[model samples]
Target: MHAALNAAQRTLVREIATLGTESGVGLYIVGGFVRDLLLGGAVREVDLVVEGDAIGFTQTVFSRLGGRVTPHRRFGTAKWRLPRELATACGWTVLDFVMARSESYARPAALPVVKRAAIRDDLLRRDFTINTLAICLDAERAGVTLDFCGGAADLQQRLINVLHPRSFEDDPTRMLRAVRFAERLGCELAPATLQLIEPARAHVAALSGDRLRHELQLVFEEKHSANVLTRLNGFSLLAAIHPALANTADAWLADKLIAAEAAGAAAEVCWLLWLYRLPAAESRLVAQRLRLPVRLTAALQQAQQLGAQRNLGRKLASSEIVSVLAGVQDWALAALVIAAQDEQVRTNLQRYRNDLRYIKPLVTGHVLRARGLAAGPQYAKVLARLRDAWLDGEIHDAAGELALLDRLLLQR
Candidate 1:
């Protein structure tokens, strides 16, 4: 397990272990970092648990490591901040620290009240059994496995199980996470855990918009996000989040999501693409419910309007395509090209993205003014005519553009 770390990570871990031993406190690598290590995947983040005042320990790290320490006293946590350049030179993680703590929720879906506790208590409080496993970082006990929750066994069995029956109830967002982990790991939800999802469906609506939206964003981030959404839809979980999402037509969704993935669309674009087929009003309702940024909500509505246009399927000149799509959100255009079936629509969208939108008349407003043409409605008319000529392949260069300009100015 120690061999999995790169040279810089090894150096930092050794230093942290030395500090923890001298201080007489236990420190362990915990959660996703350990889980990914067991899975033989490249670990992306490193989280550390200290059986001591994590804030103070983080200050110690800052004093010794020459980085900023941002401590959160209320949460018993601190971030060892490092400059990007320094972090890459030293390690992937600057060593984020959290107290090994237990949590109790007064009500379902409420944030947990926490108390500092041993590593065993902390492991039990996590979302999934797979994530409950940890590895000791203390030098004498380095690489020791701590699995009070049978997390390692579950990991071996390729199953996802909650630590307790009330797991999803206490935090509804875990339902989404459960799906995410199960799908990502190619594991199945334990039968006991699968049955609990139905009841949790009722509580999903109570979650804050930010929480639910953030979970959905993670879903889109997955490589096989289409499959995840399919599972969510089958469970009616998507509908529980929003009625408009209730029936996105699985086949259509799969196709567009695949195309979106192929296009390397951002999560925000993926989001709008998911809602691309919804009625404008329902799409707006979902956006409002999720509290999506106003720009995205507006893009969702505009994508529907633009996608609904019947004329897009017909062959059109480049300038005409621009006219139809002018001022449309780039996100909307991106979503449309993925959702569009007509070859002409896709071709025109590509043309506009790559060429038409950026094509300016060689004869500019300045040139028009220099020619003694007043800057008014006629200036716009002549420029539009000149540009259309350029779009239609009537003009190829500045010389052709000048001739077109003369004809346009004469007509004006």
Candidate 2:
């Protein structure tokens, strides 16, 4: 773990350790950083906990380290953002510092009321045992592991266990988190922990949309997202988020997602594919629940419309293809192209994506004005004709386009 630190990070960590030691404050690295390091997974986030005033600790750190510290006094937490030069050198910017604290929820899915407490109490409030593991960062004890819970045992046993039964009750969002950790860590939820899920299922509805959407985004960013999603569905957590998501056959969407990603489609296209199994109205409802960006919502709708069209064929001229697909967002067309089952349909969509969609008239409104055509709807007609001729291979060169334009003008 010490070797995992880059030179700059090593310097920063050592400085923090020295400062903590001099101040006689207990300091440790907590949460996912310790968990992943112990699991031999690559660690990125650095979460530190202090058994003292975390904001005061930050001021001390800032004086010694010459960096900015953002202290949230209400939460007994601070963010120590490194000086830019050091941050640039290390490729890591901010370190989270928190006072050891305990929490109690007033109601299901309510934000916790936090109180400063001992490290053990702080560990007790964590969602999972594995995440409760901490590593001492004092100068004399820089590598000591602290386990107030049997987190190490659970890690060795490859199990995901809640610290207490009410964990999911307090925050049903952990139900989704449980699936993520289990799938990501290659662990199974302890059977007793699994038993606690059903009763708290309804509380999943009480979670804020941002929290649920953030968790779903993490799932999609996972290397084995499909597996995580399938596991989530098995728990009926998907139904808790939205009935539309639950009704969209898990296996079908999973298969399409796998195929779409295999084609190297962009994330936007992949998202539409996730919404592909739903009816237009249900898709919008799911999008609304997830708070998908306006662009993605629009693309999903356009992709649905494309699904209903049967006229696109390989035999369609490039001009015909553009006419049919015109004004459809490029991302929507890409999703349509990826979803198409027929080779001919895929080919036609691919041509537009790769080549034909970029075809444009050599003659512009400016050129038309110079040619003595009045500035009115006639300009649009002439440009469209020129563009179509180019798209249909009727005008292969700039000279051919101009000649065609001149002849069209004479005919007009």
Candidate 3:
């Protein structure tokens, strides 16, 4: 346990213990911290749970630290956002405090009801066994782990096992949580836990778009994103989340996605590439269902259009390559350049990247204005023609640019 925490974290634990001891309430470092420690995973965030009046405890602690505390009396919860970062050689720590409480989910999609509960009860009510482990912060039990749910054994086996079968039914988001844990930890779900997913698959549709979006984003961002998606698809859960994706993403695309995932590619990039094989309408619908951000949605659209044009073969004119490069972000365009299987297409993209002519504007609005052209939207047309000529190698440098500008200015 000493090896699990760094010197700075040890200081935090000791300080927190002093406060809990003074108040006569037990404080424990619970949930993810313990699980990650036992699994030999790096702990980036720690959750401290106190089995007492959370609001008062939070206020007292905040006052001691000279920080503000906000209490939610109805929920029996409190939160303190540290004004300053805890200085640590490893990294500055940002701490938050929460009270131990039992939660009751009304419906799969509805919010949970919160009530103060014993620390053990708090641990027991969590979604999974591995996340339910806790360690006492009080002097007597300091560092002593509390594992009423057999989380330590599960961690030893590198398995994901939920606390109960109703875990998913209570909160459909846990289905995605299971996938994230499996992907992030490189672990597999226990057999019984895996069996519980399908029955609750339909309940996932009941989740709000916002909730589903957050969970799905985590799925793609995980190290095993491609594998997680494949597992979800195999279980028939993908359709419930995004019916359009399941409809259009065939076996070939799935294989591509799996390979990309294994290669340690970014999830967003892999997703965009996979969506390229889909029909435009289906892809748009899937993006909508997944609530993807506007930038990513645009990237996917551009990649699809580019993929379509790639079928036209290696003789892509300089204009087409320039247009493609201009529409995409540098990273995505670079990835597309590397992923291009056709020699001609790859060469054209590389040429656009390396050649000066592809980037130099043929004409500018200032040039148009200089030729007695009115400074309005029509100047845009003049610049576009000149730029097109330059990209097509009709213009070589400033002299050619001036010649083209002269020609456009002579017309309307």
Candidate 4:
């Protein structure tokens, strides 16, 4: 079939083809780029496969495109990332590249032994039919779509069918990918493909956490993330990954997140959906397992505390809300705001989010230290005392808080 390419895409493909020919190697635009083209979707990421040195050829092509090529000599792989602005200019509006020749998995769902191979061999090595398609980028075959596994037909049918029965076992993460493709393209998984995933779910542990996390994050970025999560739960893969994630006693938060998504909320809603169920302990476990960023970890902890207090109806008084807002930077209060059960809490959340509520502590450690309060735990205690009084409405203004601090210091 003749795959259409815009002028910019054609220009980029031409450049890659020229580079391949000049270097005496064959190159093919393969994988998701081909699949997305057949589906008429926007292609932003591109993967190119060469029948020669991937790293060497990538360096040549990147040089032509004036991109920074990072070569992984150990693995014989290379990456060329177009600048955000040039990404679209360079056929990225066409697809992103995952270039390699061929790969052979040692064990089912284990790392592959990669080596150079013909374009056909490379395409045949892919997990699914839709992903096995390739577009010839060379001048001789430009616009020619190659489908060794009937990927074009499957694309037409909007089906996610494995290239082989053992496809899932070769990489169980493909099960999630199948689900993502089904949701992203409004396709259905072939019956055999759906059946194959369950038995292969055990193989997921063999896959790297980074790979699994990437797939999970992609699924969550989808509009049907909640539905996808439900599907994963139904397939029993969710529990297999993290047993704690199963049987969520309170799925209200999940439901709320789904509702928010249905109303066109952004990706942050997905993070909040899991926060209610992920208490401090579980959050820490997950963070450790996922190697979460420190900022995200702290945010999760704060959200957990806020969720617990909100659940307990600890009615975030004006002061409590202000204090919480002061310490949080990122999505710190996302769960509290998203899962807030009370109108007052929601209103306060809005005020805090809009920067309408700012608290300038009326008393400081310096003042307390000067007032016969020695440094150390006492400084912390005095500050905490004043902050509490301010939050609890015991101190209404700076003068009132200072007066209370003075009296409290004198008593001390």
| Per-prediction tally of clashes | 0, 0, 0, 9
Residue-level error in angstroms, candidate 2, position 232: 1.7
Q: In model 4, where do residues sit more than 4 Å from their true spots?
A: 1-6, 83-99, 248-254, 259-269, 310-318, 357-412
Model 3 alpha-carbon drift over 4 Å, by segment: 20-25, 52-94, 247-251, 258-265, 310-312, 329-341, 346-373, 382-412
User: What digit string (tens of lDDT, one per residue) describes model 3 on residues 259-364?
Assistant: 6666566767776765666688988887887787888888887776776684435676777666556656543554465456777876776676668234657466
Give the range of the ten consecutive residues with the poorest summed lDDT in model 2. Answer: 247-256
Cα deviation at 82, candidate 1, in Å, is 2.4
Off by over 4 Å in 1: 22-25, 67-69, 90-95, 361-389, 399-412
Query: Which predicted model would earn the best TM-score?
Result: 1
Please list all clashing residue pairs in model 3, or write none if there are none. none
lDDT-better candidate, 1 vs 3: 1
Model 1: weakest 10-residue lDDT segment is: 85-94
- Runs of candidate 2 with Cα error greater than 4 angstroms are 16-26, 50-85, 247-249, 264-268, 360-385, 402-412
Write the residue-wise lDDT of candidate 2 on 1-412 in tens digits: 6877888888888888889999888899998988888888799698999998889998899998788989898789999888999899887888889999999999999989999988888888999999999999987777999898899899989999999889999999899999999988999999999999999999988887778888887776666667787888888888999987774536666776677667776667767777776888888888888788888788888888877878875579888888888788887887777677788888888888888878898778889989989899989888988999988778899999999999989987
Distance from true position, residue 81, model 4, in Å? 3.1
Evaluate all candidate structures by whole-model CA lDDT and list the values in order: 0.86, 0.85, 0.74, 0.71
**TM agreement with the true structure for every prediction:** 0.89, 0.85, 0.79, 0.79
User: Please, what are the lDDT tens digits per residue for candidate 1 over residues 264-286?
Assistant: 99877889878887777787788
